[model samples]
Target chain A: MIINHPLLGPRDAQEFTYLGDASLISRPDAQDDNAAEKFHDYLYLRDNPAGLHRELWFHESGDRSWLVVTRNTVTHEITDVQLARDVARKEGRSK
Target chain B: MRYSGFKVIKEALTGHKGWTPQWRDPEPQSHYDFVIIGGGGHGLATAYYLAKEFGESRIAVLEKGWIGGGNVGRNTTIIRSNYLLDGNEPFYEFSLKLWEGLEQDFNYNAMVSQRGILNLVHTDAQRDAARRRGNAMILNGSDAELLDVEGVRKLYPFLNFDNARFPIKGGLLHRRGGTVRHDAVAWGYARGADMRGVDIIQNCEVTGFKIEDGTCLGVETTRGYIGAGKVGVSVAGSSSRVMEKAGMRLPMESHVLQAFVSEGLKPVLPGVITYGAGHFYCSQSDKGGLVFGGDIDGYNSYAQRGNMPVIEDVAEGGISLIPALGRVRLLRAWGGIMDMSMDGSPIIDKTHIDGLYFNGGWCYGGFKATPAAGWCFAHLLKTDTPHDTATAYRFDRFRTGHMIDEKGQGAQPNLH
Candidate 1:
């Protein structure tokens, strides 16, 4: 599987580590009353769709950047790839 | 129908007209006392045990596709209790014992072959680890033998023992551990469950869950909404997705694990053999096909297919261990979705939702744990408590720092 990284151009999927759904970056506020439950959901819950899915893949063997790859789980077709941090920032998620 | 030599002869004499479908394809009823969301081996076994042992009735196993079309039928078919951890060893040993009496218990021929399994050691540290694991197995009331280099060579003379990169130092042999007919296991369990009046509903896709005020009432499927007193989710790869409908998240990842089978040949592998230096394990099936598999795709996927790199990597491992395999033709390759848990151990426990239960995260051990998983899961559903053998497979283990990390991989799903 060739994952075309945003910065590293095209790289083999073997070099990356899978971190599962990209929704992980949108963690809830830690100060909320339901922070524990929210954190639990953030860490564990996944919308593992059978078709198109956005997942987090770390380029461990390349630039060390986490890439959010929009892929079809059924066909394994990669439609888009971007830095996970950039995607998180675009989605109004920040440290 | 009782399957026997006489029945076979009679059927043959009568042109095989006495045969019936192994299981009934019943329409989904409006409600059942127990609803199992997957018709794979574990789910069917759960239903079978619920009826046979727990004296429960009105059970139904719902499968999106045909039975045995999941990881239950896609594995290397090896069953072993050579685990090194307390959280996993006893449970697997129990499963092994169930496999021993499975044919008589189910009244069907499952081909539970206890040929043995050898984990080849390649280094001094590996030898020490194998010794520790063997000791653990013995402590758990299972057999384990540490075979020296000469013993390994005697059993498998065709191995690439003299190779410099990964020399064969010794091995850990579990004599009671071996392979079974993967599909036959599903069939036997389904037949047993069906005979016990458990409805096996196929082509029933569960689209959502019907949870009311923190209690599961039923499931909404493609066919329709079916009510249930309790629901058990045993969908291996789709555990995360299925549970999501109930507003629950699981600390598990779904990845595609590919397996391969070579063309038939003269019987070569006496039993199962696993490479110490790599993730390659293989055994010769009854039909003489060399069935083998390696690592997952290292990516989350619900797809039941794999790519070429993993295939090439598995082939490389096979060649590194058995140089003779280089000349053999690869007949077919397939994939199964592995429900890899954070701690590399399975969870068979009730969910936070009141009437919902879960039995998954079997990882690569799903097929081997089929019998005990079913039995223990049925016990949990019937009595609302974990079986003695599966007490450590609780959902709170991860949060409580009691992760049953058999491989000690430390939260890495792919590594496990």
Candidate 2:
């Protein structure tokens, strides 16, 4: 299945339970950074500081800034995104 | 009193006569909490707002050139909230509010004259668009007046009435919009930010950033590598180069926009005027000079110099609007590089990389949007979430079908 862009973790393209337009969840294959790309714009999977995830982000506006996406690698869909911010904290990345 | 005045004058003259004292260079800081890339209006204003909002007073605004040496100083300084697009309306309206209070906020005289801005519509389609925009403004709680040809003639009697080439029709009058001192805006924000303990670094070019393991730690400047917790890239024209240093290619075009001024005359035009059909807009400055400009050089060049074509086009449109300006001698003209985006709005959000934020692609309206942009950018950097209006300006909105393409030419301006 498709996963997050290699650079920005799995959160960029997470799958979610279909929420209404108010849901801030991201879609697996949709290339939007605003989390409006989710299935009806709902958050499906929640991120756990306990586990690692893969995400995909597509910078569609062409501003060159990448969207830090996070998603579940198993389901192959997007859940959340932190565009321009890294997946792990500064300390976490070094390790 | 006379002797005191003479003594002050003598001291000032002595100060000036003594070997043309060199300006003091800013001392390189060991480290700063935040480092802004550009020293233009946005950078200085961002520093000011950062200090104001977050109480994090230790910020530095680094510039390759002197302050206001970029688009901040090069713009024609027209302030208006006449935008018809969804993404630009609220942001510009907030800027208008800030402009109204800039004097008290910055404690500097910006000479903000809200003499109203008028956009003339020569075609029926344009008139309808103007009407729709005016109605939208009313619905959004902003002020706009839809004036007929007679109303426009009554307001601006000097406009050429019978000229055949797209003769004067009605206009969309925004009474709250106007002009301000562009230089003082940069200076005011600099002074205010500096007062709040933010370092205003000039002539210090950032060579590159210090990135490791896909996270930005700090920047590598001409001076040296300075460590930082967060970095805000407010560089407008140099966005591509800056992002490239971090291994990113932005969909941006570097274009040169030119502004011209004519010989000073008696006060003629009272407010900023724009011709929709002719692609020309102008405003009579406080000094009585007709300040105006049109589109860019239509090529991707960083050079801040324009040719005769734009000058001719702008002047021709000016002459069409006011036949009397044909005799006036052109005085001075200049150009600045604009970091035009695929969509005409700005991008103010965090990047995929950790600790790297951006605020660029403002187009022609960046001058007036300075305050609101700085505020929103500051909020984003502090909270890690986009503000209300800027939420639509995210980098991923394009692929998700949420593009706020106000001037819906789509793709890019040149291609569209």
Candidate 3:
């Protein structure tokens, strides 16, 4: 598998570290009334779809930047790649 | 027909003309007393136990594909209960015990070889950990032995004891642990269940759950809607997707684990061996192929194929431990989906939806737990309560912070 980095051309997937679904970026608020429930759902629950999935992959060997790669789980065909920081900043509202 | 030595002799004398199909291919009934999704080893065993042990009939095992096409046929076929935790050791030991009498009970030859398993301990810390695990296995009514270097050498003298990085210090041996004919397990249970009037429906894919008022009525399948009094989902790798139709998310990730088999050679490995310092294990199949495998691909994937790096890594680990493996040519490599759970343990419990139950998150070790998993899941489906051995595998454990973390990896699916 090759991840086409935004700054650095395409790189082998071995140079990167996987952290699973990108939805993990949206952590639950710790000070909420139902924080335990929310945190439990956040930590344990997953939408492990068999189709297209947006997941986080850190370029640990090259740029040390996290990228959200939208790839199909069935065929492993990558369709989109974006910096997770930009995606996080664009959706800046916190829980 | 009852299979016996007399029947074999009669058939042999008669030119084997009276043989019959192992299992019947039946159309799905409109409704069933119990509906088990996924016709893998666990699902078939569940139906078998439900009829034979629990005295419940009207059971149907629905398979998207044919039986023995899933993880049941893809695993490395190793079975052991050499565990270290209270929440796990007893359950696995129960599974091992069931494995002991499985062939006779199911009336089929699964080739339950109790050769044993040796877990190589490299560092001092690893040796201490193995010692504790062995003691735990012993206390759980499972056999375990702590073997010194010379003792391990006597068993197999071809280990790299002089390696500076990962020197062999000691080993833990589980005497009653070994391998079984994995594909035959699925067939045996299917036949046993079918003989007891359970429907074995193949080419039936469950698309959605027909739930009303938070109560599961049945499943919407490719064949048609089939109602059931109780629904049990034992889909291994597709746990998350299957439960999603019932509006439930699982505490698991779907990852791909690849296994390899080399060209057939004379019996080299007498039993299973696992490297404590590295992610590798090896055993010899009945066909003489060296069956071996390592870690998962360490990423979420629904694809049943893996990347090349993991293959290379596994080969490296194999040659590093047994340099003789470097000469053997690998014949085939295949991958299966693993529902890796948080805390690295399985979950077999009732869902919030009434009349619905789940049995998955088995990680990479579901093959060993097939017999007990079915027995316990059948018990739960029949009695509406978990079996005694599997009481700890509840959904509430993660919520109550009582996760059964055998590997001590907290909430990480890939690490386990």
DockQ, in order, for the candidates?
0.52, 0.02, 0.88
lDDT of 1 by residue, B92-151 (tens): 999999999999999898899999999999999999999999999999999999999999
Chain B of candidate 2 achieves a TM-score of: 0.93
**lDDT against true structure, model 2:** 0.73
Better of 1 and 3 by lDDT: 3
List pairs with backbone clashes in candidate 1: none
* Backbone atom clashes (below 3 Å) for every candidate: 0, 31, 0
Q: For residues B1-416, could you state the per-residue lDDT of candidate 3 as single tens digits?
A: 88999999999999999999988888999999999999998999999999999998899999999998999999999999998888899999999999999999999999999999999999889888888888888899999899999999999899888788998887999999999999999999999999999999999999999999989999999999999999999999999999998988899999999999999999889999998878999999999999999999999888999999999999988888898998999999999999999988999999999999999999999999999999999999999988999999998898999999988889889889
Order of candidate numbers by DockQ, starting with the best: 3, 1, 2
Runs in model 1 deviating more than 4 A are A23-45, A88-95
Worst 10 residues of 1 chain B by lDDT: B407-416
Global Cα lDDT for candidate 3: 0.93
Runs of candidate 2 with Cα error greater than 4 angstroms are: A1-95, B1-25
